[model samples]
Target: MPPATPPSPARRPGYGERRGELVQAAIRVVAAQGIAGLSHRSVAREAGVTHGLVRHHFGTMTSLIAEALDTILPQSLRRNPVSLLLADPGYPEEDLVSWIDEQADLQVFEYEVLLATRHTPELRPLAERLYRGYEDSVRSAFAEHDLPAPADAHVTLILAAIEGLVLHRVTFRRDDGPTITAAFVALREAIRLAVAADGAPST
Candidate 1:
């Protein structure tokens, strides 16, 4: 008989640090393996923590996923689309696309968690609040550009469009630059036309 190998030492809890660490690890896990592969053990393995710590830090698995979204939402909204349309966020960054490329995992993880929110009722409110923040940025961005933005209902549609664009490209790993550029061009034109029709003064 072969000799029994010793088990690897159990990872120690991060205590307060585990909250943030686990959230980020969960994001990486989802990005690397997709949301379907996310599990307590998977996240623990990614986070280098014992599996029990996942349950300890986050009572429900869904809550951990929700927190991961919460963690990345602010980074996603760090600068409004208008800022990128004008110039990059400035200093310590190049542009939104650059930032997205740099944080590809986080960005991809964001959409995955977003899909999870669609079916997870308990996590939906957190998603809604996070979305409101993005919406606020969208409203502010257009307003700053003196552009007429969509109303709440229409804003939802626009957001869906933007989401689809990013999701499709990111999922396929396609570099359809012209198509993506044209989409933004169309969006800018629409905003400009709407503002013009509204007879709004330009900023």
Candidate 2:
């Protein structure tokens, strides 16, 4: 009988420094090429690594794209949306609205991913997972304020408005910030009223 060859070692990143570098490279690749532009070879070129290494680190383009979105997307929200929302226990209505307006105007990368999702069915699941994660994150923020369980419809609207604002901003170069702020302000008030009606004493 012929001798069997040993299997190749798995290609996951080593951890700590290298892993973060690999992820950041993937983010740039996504930013440049859109999610559809993500390929092991393309990402490897972007990261200045061997194609085999990129595959080893991320396994597949889908995983790489998902990770890219995961790492970069939240910071856009955390830096702008979440940070502003949490900054003041008494966050003025205008500050809250302006923050949302700013986020909607910035971060065109999300629009790229959303467009890619329409063509790549594999991406849809990852996109859904990411959206759900955002919804949960937003919900947790409201919960911290002793707010009621926010209605799913409102969350959906917020997500849609954000997406629409990005689309309008990128496609027509139009400003949708004020419109987005108006919608968000309405949702915020609804949440606050619901929280007050729930009668949970604010901590």
Candidate 3:
């Protein structure tokens, strides 16, 4: 018989769980009560952990807020998992609208954080970075469709249109109607045209 290898070292107890719990708890609080409601005690209570643990782990409320915002991406994906990145060949590029709809709650959570950032000088940089990430994803999806590289303004325009549609629907639409769907189709077509090279077929 081959020589047996030594066993792997045991993992630290509850290390990842504690941090993840606090971050998720923060997200739930923001999602349910808005960013204005987030506090050390609130998140601690949500996570069922000590207030000092939250402070000891994050050191400050802003740091905790940042972590919560950062977590939305992964949390959102898990709930409404995307099958492919825009970089993948044969990916259903048109399905982007549907995908965004599935992640609506996550988007709402992010928008709350963004609104909070305007009043928080320390939070602006991270929020800007987060938005740039959204832009990059948009650019990638555009690239996958063989669309030409859009200018920064064009990227911003597309992102603004899509996010606005989402926000408008979430804020106003209460019934199970295709209001957002109709708007998204028009927005998607507009984006396809915007990314097309001059004189390319608009179809």
* Each prediction's TM-score versus the true structure: 0.74, 0.64, 0.76
Could you give the candidate ranking by TM-score, starting with the highest? Answer: 3, 1, 2
lDDT of 2 by residue, 142-181 (tens): 6665556666776666556545544554555456556655
Q: Write the per-residue lDDT of candidate 1 for residues 77-171, one digit (tens) a residue.
A: 67565445533332222243454456778778877767777777776777778888777776777677555664676456556656665665577
Higher-ranked by lDDT: 1 or 3: 1
Q: How do the residues 1-203 of candidate 3 rate in per-residue lDDT, one tens digit apiece?
A: 99999999997548777888888788778777888888889989998889999888989878887776677655544522112322334344445546666666567678887887778889888788787767776666556556576778877887787678667755664753466656655665665566555336567
As for lDDT, the candidate ahead, 2 or 3, is 3
Better of 1 and 2 by TM-score: 1
CA shift of 183, model 1, Å: 2.6
RMSD in order of candidates: 7.6, 10.1, 6.5
Superposition TM-score, candidate 3 onto the true structure: 0.76
Number of the top-ranking candidate, with TM-score as the measure? 3
> Which candidate tops lDDT?
1
